[model samples]
Target: MEINVIEKIENPLLNRTEIHFDCTYQGEATPKVLDVKNRLVATLNVDKNLLVVHNLKPSYGEGKANGYAKLYDSEENLNKIEMDHVVMKNKEATKEEKEEAE
Candidate 1:
């Protein structure tokens, strides 16, 4: 998959950066948030721990996708505002949380 950043907007009130991007991939399957997060981290030269890929959706039968993501100033700030399920899906589960879930 290839990622191209289309736009970036800073939300000072939220202490986050909002991103819009496009992805080109060579398969029918939809791309995952983890993979998108990795690409965004590399492209933005930011820490993976500070990035959260909130959404990625492919255009039907087009092999292209458009998505939005949020880059937080800190994990604590992120947790205070972002939805629980989005945080859960985008970040790696902590050891304690992993153990509890298991």
Candidate 2:
């Protein structure tokens, strides 16, 4: 699977960064991970140490459904797994500081 970051927006109310990305499944006629002409939203909250992601638009077409994955950086390693949300936190950190830390 291949993914690319498309756009991003900072949400002050949520104190998180919302990232939109274009994902493509590179294989032989495999199902897509997301719907076409729709955007996927991933929220990264470092202050709360959480990452929440969801499909902004659900797939309406027939066939296999799209998939989503949550990734995290822990213990100096990157872990990719299935999850609904992710959380992390550290002292002496501001929301702006945390976003820059990413």
C-alpha lDDT of all candidate models, in order: 0.88, 0.38
15-44: candidate 2 lDDT, tens digit per residue: 445556545554334433332222232223
Clashing pairs in 2: 49-87, 49-88, 50-86
- Model 1: per-residue lDDT, tens digit, 1-102? 889999999999999999999999976577788888888899999988878888888888899999999999998998898998988788766799989998
> How much is the lDDT of residue 41 in candidate 2?
26
* RMSD (Cα, Å) of model 2: 13.3
As a whole number from 0 to 100, the lDDT of residue 76 in candidate 2 is 23
Model 1 weakest lDDT span, ten residues long:
26-35
- On TM-score, the leading prediction is 1
TM-score of 2: 0.36
RMSD of each: 2.6, 13.3
